[model samples]
Target: GKVPILLPPLPEQKKIAQILSTWDQAITATERLLENSQQRKKGLMQLLLTGKKRLPGFEGEWETRKLKELCAIKTGKKDVNEGNPDGKYPFFTCASEPTGSDEYSYDCEALLIAGNGIIGKTHYFKGKFEAYQRTYILSDFSNAVSVSYLHQFILYWLMRDIDREKQHGAMPYIKLGLLQRFNVFVPSIEEQQRIAMVLSYADQEIDGLEFKLNLLKQEKKALMQQLLTGKRRVNVETEAA
Candidate 1:
């Protein structure tokens, strides 16, 4: 148990509580919207990536193929120290921020899939980049499947697997062979591009909503700092001259 805390006088307490309540309500609403948008994106990925829902004008059965048949896979060459802080290329690692590097092992559209820590997380990138040894870089997709479509579909598949079976042991790890042998249902190039385009637009909407949520949170933080410290006052309507 803990000791009870002191409180401000009645009027000031009521005013502060009222003002903070409005902000709390706003934050809750924004969070709900964000949750709904995220769920919608997941639903879209499940449908589009699995070929359960086809875009208009799309006909013919989707071909099922292993990942190795579609793209080339490889691990990175550069060590941790080899990465540069102020370099032109992206050096991906298991960490949150991608390291920078002057040199690159691959220079084309690729998916950087975390093979060790934060395993199954994937990043889609086009252009020159470097990767950590444990990270798997997949590129050079075939004409049957667009790179963008494959990237999204693979990520969706990984998400499903990771969600069901969380970790392998103490650390989650993905093997190159597992990634290579992964099976996927792919539509024609035209249909794949169409699905990718729709998902991309959906991503844009989610991004916009998330940005708004962040702004609201920042605003609320600033307000709490100002109000609680008595730096700013809540100017409630009053019967005064």
Candidate 2:
């Protein structure tokens, strides 16, 4: 069987190719930026968690602590309907985003761990926030060996352990008891704050770049759709006969 190949005129084809090439370049640049961010974050985690890299204003030997030894974990109250209109508290759920409640649940700074479904996801919350049943809220900062240090340590440790224990099934589950047994390496409070600040700054930059890249891609897509459909023609035109 013979296959027929249809080709556009040279000029039109070149214009199409040039537009696609621009998209390719944008995609490649975005991918490189994403890869760089991931690599940098991984490197920072390795160094900061292990005490290989020391931040400014901190000098202390890192310590090991069981997760349960440092913080008190509280299951979130399942009271979404109790949200008060004049309340000023942020409501949290198993997912990272805030819920539609203004009532405060936990009254202090703490780390929130997802208790079911996509388990082991952690978020640091300050002041007060209402938490749902699927989340475990950590409290008792004074009792913690070092609150800031423990927070970072637990985050890294939780992610590692959860990835390891996740079963090959439809859903991943991390039992609260199992999670509390996870081990962690902790530095002094000062070191913890320093490491968190540095990594957080990097994360902010990466997020900003991602937002800009998304906007650019959206603009490029709109341009391509308009130009290809002839709704928004470019300045170039076909030569008259």
Candidate 3:
């Protein structure tokens, strides 16, 4: 049996629905904007990583290298109990949980790749943080061929290869050896920075927009609950017949 909708009188129902419809329209518009931005970001990544799009003041061919050639995979400490209450360090795990400790493990900016169950997930850690054993830290960026460029490159490569490597009956895992053999497209440092910056900006904007949309949705939901329940009513004067 279909649940009956406790709609108000015809005119009031129309008004309530109209208000909700306006909110829906705003949500739809915001969602479309987010999608467009994401699509553009993807396009930028394709062009920038492939060297087809060159940012102003940058000129050079990109170099190619394997993951091991550019970074040393450092595993995090395994002591979960080592978390300190007074410690002031950020903790990271394969699941992106910040629930470990406040101690510095690797003191530098490098890309962190999930090495075990949630393999190939990449995070750029720029501050002091404690990382879980299941996570692998990338260090030695300064001496590498192109650290920043390779950082983004590995992300793109992982995005492409992760699903293909996930086999049924076997847990998804990214072996360090496999990462070592993974090919990377390295652009000049300047170009690499440019591309990373552009993509990062897009991501930030998307996050901000999503946050705003969520807030707006919550507000709309609250309004609907109150208005639909007859707890709040809009004033509508009727003329004498």
Candidate 4:
């Protein structure tokens, strides 16, 4: 048996190859930008969350406290199966996007953590939201710890816990007791606000880059459809322009 191949004329095939290669290079460049931005975010988390880095407007050492001391933790009342697709409120089942909810269990600035499936994932949101019974909700933040700062701290350290869990090869789960005992470093409320602001800006920048990447991908997809089908032919001399 012989391998299959496209039978376009040599010149036309070469033109198509060159055009596709250009698109591939563009996509690869945007992908690299996305990866770099994500890495920068992780680096920022290490420095800012640990109090190793500080914003210019504020200065002070961070306090050490258990996770429970910063906020209260409780599991949701509804099970994952209880979520309704057409409900009005946001209903979180696990780590991914939330379903719709007719009612909400809490309405505040809170952190949502997965307790079972795809565990250790976390979400922070303001206003009303519903959660699965296995979803751990951390709300009623303490005055000593800024909620956003605390969210960052958890986001930073949760990676370590995830890595450790991978070593065990056991099902991922977040025990309420374990979270209650987990400790974190906390700066003054004002300093926390500044750190959160900086990180928020970083996230926005990364998000903007992602949007551009998506547009580039869409453009390439449309271009391929036109070029491959010969609906929009590319002139070899156009490359010079």
Give lDDT per model, in order.
Answer: 0.81, 0.70, 0.74, 0.81
For model 1, the stretches where C-alpha displacement exceeds 4 angstroms are 1-9, 81-88, 167-171, 238-241
The sequence of per-residue lDDT tens digits that candidate 3 reaches over residues 1-241 is 7977776788777777777888899989988988888887778778887888888998866677877777777778855567764668766666644554656766888787777645677777787788777777888764545555666677776766776656443446666677778877776666677788887897888888888789879988998888888898765445111
Model 3 weakest 10-residue run by lDDT: 232-241
**TM-score per candidate, in order?**
0.86, 0.76, 0.79, 0.85
> Model 4 segments beyond 4 Å from truth?
1-8, 236-241
Taking the tens digit of each residue's C-alpha lDDT, what string does model 2 give over 1-241? 5866444556765676577678779877987887799778778877888888788777877777767777776688865456553557767666555555666656788888777745777777788678877778888754435565566666676777676666445236556777577676677666667777777777787887788688878878877776665565443375211
Count of backbone clashes, every candidate in sequence = 0, 0, 0, 0
Residue-by-residue lDDT tens digits, candidate 4, 71-143: 8889999977777899988997785777888899889888888888767778888988898999889998888
Give the CA lDDT, 0 to 100, for residue 35 in model 2: 76
Model 1: per-residue Cα lDDT at residue 168: 50
Cα distance off (Å), candidate 2, residue 51:
2.7
Clashing pairs in 4: none
In model 2, state the lDDT of residue 107. 77
What is the C-alpha local distance difference test score of candidate 3? 0.74
Compute the lDDT for candidate 2.
0.70
The TM-score ranking, best first, is 1, 4, 3, 2
